[model samples]
Target: MMISRKLVYVASLSLGLSLLASTAMAKVEMNAMCFMKQSESTAHAFNPTKEEIADSSILKKNPTNVTDADVDAKFRIASLSKVITTDWAIAKLGPEYRFKTKIYVTPGTKAGNCNLHIEGDMDPYMGREMLTRIFTQLKPKLTAQSCKYIETFSYDQYFPVYLDAMKHQTNHDLGWEDPARYFNSTKTKNDLAAFLKVKSGLKGDFSNIGVVTKDRYQEYLKGVPSKVYSVKSRPLFMIAKDMNKYSYNYPPNVLFEKLGGAEAYKKFAADRLKLDGEDVEMYNGSGYPAMIDGKKMYNLVSCSALVHIMQDLDKTLEAYKGTRKFQMADVMAVGGPGESYSTFKGLYAGGTYDNTMVAKTGSADKAITFGGMLSTADGDMYFAVLTSPETYGGADTTKARVIIRELVQTLAERQKLKKFEYKQIGDMNATDDQSTLVEEPKQTPAGSLK
Candidate 1:
């Protein structure tokens, strides 16, 4: 009996040590893979830095030959900046926060000349159909009062002016000839007038509508502006879904404005994320236009800093998943075969990463970036890959995407060996069974934006 017990103990100890050795080997492999080769053309300029953290321990880091300054160096994260903007908005405003547009009516001196004020709360997704609904709700009241003509029609001047400046700045940076592409304040007002006219059966075009100056905006505040009706935008999470999925610029730009412009946004992120002043910097919500004033001034964030932010975002989202109908995957683009906004779907779809990676991708002339959480058998792993401008140029994102995939796949494989229970946040639609995998969720219809 003593000899049998000794044999069993020896076997168990050998198995434990083997597992540890395997884990250590996997870590070494991952560390080696993280060091990407620099391009010959710009080998001098190429500076690649990556950091991966799992369970509060650094799994892989390539800091050799790269100084602390290089590790801390900020690269233009491109659309990855959207992750920061959307994450910040979600934290500050909650996932369910909605933008409100209010309609006010006041008696006019003449029989058919009452003033109508449409106050906008910077709702970026407000569309013609939504305006029609607002007008439809207020039609009965207006018709009952015999209000045939709108004597003075005005909207919030502050937001329109700010939007104009933002549009101009974006156009200037992109060298876009048509500033109207970004935003046309006049067109928006006119569209609102047309929609309201059709819905309310009112007469005349916006020529009859008056523009409210900053000074005139206060007059409506003197007397209680009789509220006729109002419309609330879709929840912030839904907006975030479209923003990250499509890499839409307007929504995030407007959101940053709502958060009190770029400078204020930086301060807010620094305070909330506990990041140093140099750790995060963003001129615009989107990281396009890699330069400003001859110097490349794109949104700069270190890999580790972004990974930490992503981890915090994951925790914040977990708190809401149980109570809310939407999940983090619903807001972020997922990898797979179907119509996903995941830029990596072309390369990673139908592969091992399908439905397992929920991330954001950013690319421009000088920088390529990707950062998000990867669900593994052990647990969730937060990762961010930032390639210096020298690594990619002109339409070639293949190298970056390929490297990211290999690294993630290696990590997943290592986790699988541990036999750790697979736990994932939200519904990632992941599966170990090869036969069960399907395409990603279809794109949300335009009407659903409401």
Candidate 2:
């Protein structure tokens, strides 16, 4: 008896599906084993529920604690908060937004002495090199005036106020121990002054350098004096990249203050991302809040909430990519086996998973978290994992890295079994591979400037 063509096609389809199901079952088992190893009753682990970005379908999840790993359970995200802060900044401030510092000269009665006023716009990355650049631009003007000594160097008073606010907001008491030293404004100012003195052959030392009073500051803003030059910060993405790559606390804290603090950022996230307010709690943008009663009061965000935020951020980034050279990978830290600014750089670099993982890592006394995107041959998957203090016994970054590596490997293997190609979000290759070796450039010393 001759079988119909339709019957033959149906038979082939049945066999294909059976093989697919068998492979999927094997993946589930592997994920379960991986989760069990981490779950060992010692740590509370919130593993990833991998999904296809194209269709938002769950590709794989830990089989053991599917119910325990409540997607909405709040976990302290530590430095992972940088991811949210950076994305919010990109959305609200725009990726190209540059902080500005306006320079003004109040001509002095003394031939060699002049008062130099620096009106800061909170350029977080303002540093010695940037100062050199700004001063170089101002050198010709200073020479034209025959300026020899900077008798008085003043900055916007708001700079210190903002820094103080960050200290208070993050409950960083250590920030005040030597506000002058910690802020490093005085040193920066001295450095700038020294740089100018040497460059211009000035004789006298920079005598009076401090914050401008409100009354005096107003006059300068009204164009009473000569405006000399202005220097702009690097693009916001560059700053955000450093914030995530090194888990730097100050940049995000400053950004948080610019947004009007914790409550403000929460409202912004809720309204813009459509996230539930209760699911997202942030006391500071840096995710390094003061501890209370032996527990950290860091930012709290659910794994599910974080994953959703990442998805929304990816969409925003994709939209921006159409008009400019911007992508989420351009801002967030890349992990897994490369000379990149990754928390896991030394541990995972040149390993089996090298160049496949891009993530932000967070660690506080009470928790450690990892959230970002993982790229596989099938596609990119956004994920978040939270390990509680009670579970891990403390913030064990080494353990966290190991688990995250295993988790990513499991998801990649699972994706292989499904044979589903996920749409890539951004260029995974666009990373600063050298960031692993060198530390992020320190901000201009705020105290030194004072």
Candidate 3:
């Protein structure tokens, strides 16, 4: 009896060890790809039949058997979310739109003493250079006409400062700093006052910055300003161009919030691109991760949906009427030695791939993705590569990037697409005219500027 029991225990231990080994081997990583050749008008599926295989056919690979579901499976796309945000802005706001900041002066009891009211549109590109221009313009007007020192300053609720949200009026904190380190609005009130004093170079203590009730601000908006001046930001397309080239997180988030958040974005995606809700879960515009239900979630987008977005964006930019022509390279990072500051310059800079690709690269703790158009012999090939090392037999980011580079190189060679060339029309980092001052209409009728 004792010998039989010992044999049974040994068998059970062996089975348990076998199961553990199997589970360990199953923890491999995964990769998915979707390629759409413009000429074929079809997205290639992964590892398709030889006859069905083409540059446009949607293709993908994984540890398990590849299926159509994998093509539509949502993957956290990291900074690629900026592409979607740019698309929305181009469609809704147009390429020429510029953000505005309006200023109103209400003279105080003493001459040349005014209580200042600034209405901001949450300009995402507000930086030292832009701020310097605004203050430079303000100095002459404020010192000559209204007030040498702003007796008290108040701005709209949307001002990107740390104190405004802490007053318990907003739903959440607005102290989060953007990736550009431009405004640094997360600091305390004193920091703002000191910063403003230096930026303006005026002889006034600006520590008395105040906030008015929402009702009062609205009333002021409806009433014509007795004394007013305004500053406008660079056009929307230029802003979008810089945002993507640098992959700055703040600009897209501001634009996203201005466009009505995730729910609105979902509706837009569904209606415009026919993207299914399951494949388009965007919590924020920047593609930054969020915490929900005690779990961290990044912006999830399927490979097909992302390709479709790139296709649509290209078309939209092509058709847009503007002073100067716009192309995908204008709004996306170009892969070449020409654009020294672009995020993808280093990766695709060799002579063979140089300037032939305009792409966006996204990375997260678990996800490394690349998506955009590849100029090909057949036509422009829109593609998305989503990779993660968390799945079964997964590889780290470095290995995944190497694999992708080789894959892209192979595809280019197979299709005879390496001959395509993209000559940048102007310097990507060229600055627009900053001195052009757009004065708001002296009399803005009731609710017109709102």
The C-alpha lDDT values of all candidates are 0.53, 0.54, 0.63
TM-score of each: 0.67, 0.66, 0.78
| CA error at residue 406 for candidate 3, angstroms | 1.5
User: Candidates 1 and 3: which is better by TM-score?
Assistant: 3
The deviation in Å at residue 96 for candidate 1 is 0.9
Better lDDT candidate (2, 3): 3
Clashing pairs in 1: none
Q: Report the lDDT tens digits of candidate 2 across residue range 1-450.
A: 112324322533233234434434222111111121111212123334534222111223222253344556676777888888887888888887877666766566676556677777666555444555566556566666777666777777434222222232234333223222323456555655555556534445465556776467766546444544565666777677766665667667667666676777777877887776667988767777644577647677776667767766666766774346665666776543343334544333312333455567766655666666655444455677665533332223334444444454444444431112222222222123221212123232222111
What is the Cα-based TM-score of model 2?
0.66
Worst 10 residues of 1 by lDDT: 35-44
Question: Between candidates 1 and 3, which one is better according to lDDT?
Answer: 3
* lDDT per residue as tens, model 3, 34-88: 7887655456644434432332111222222445777788887888899999999
How big is the RMSD of model 1?
A: 14.2
Off by over 4 Å in 2: 1-69, 158-207, 213-216, 220-223, 291-296, 321-323, 335-338, 347-356, 376-380, 390-397, 416-450
| Backbone clash count for every predicted candidate, in the order shown | 0, 19, 21
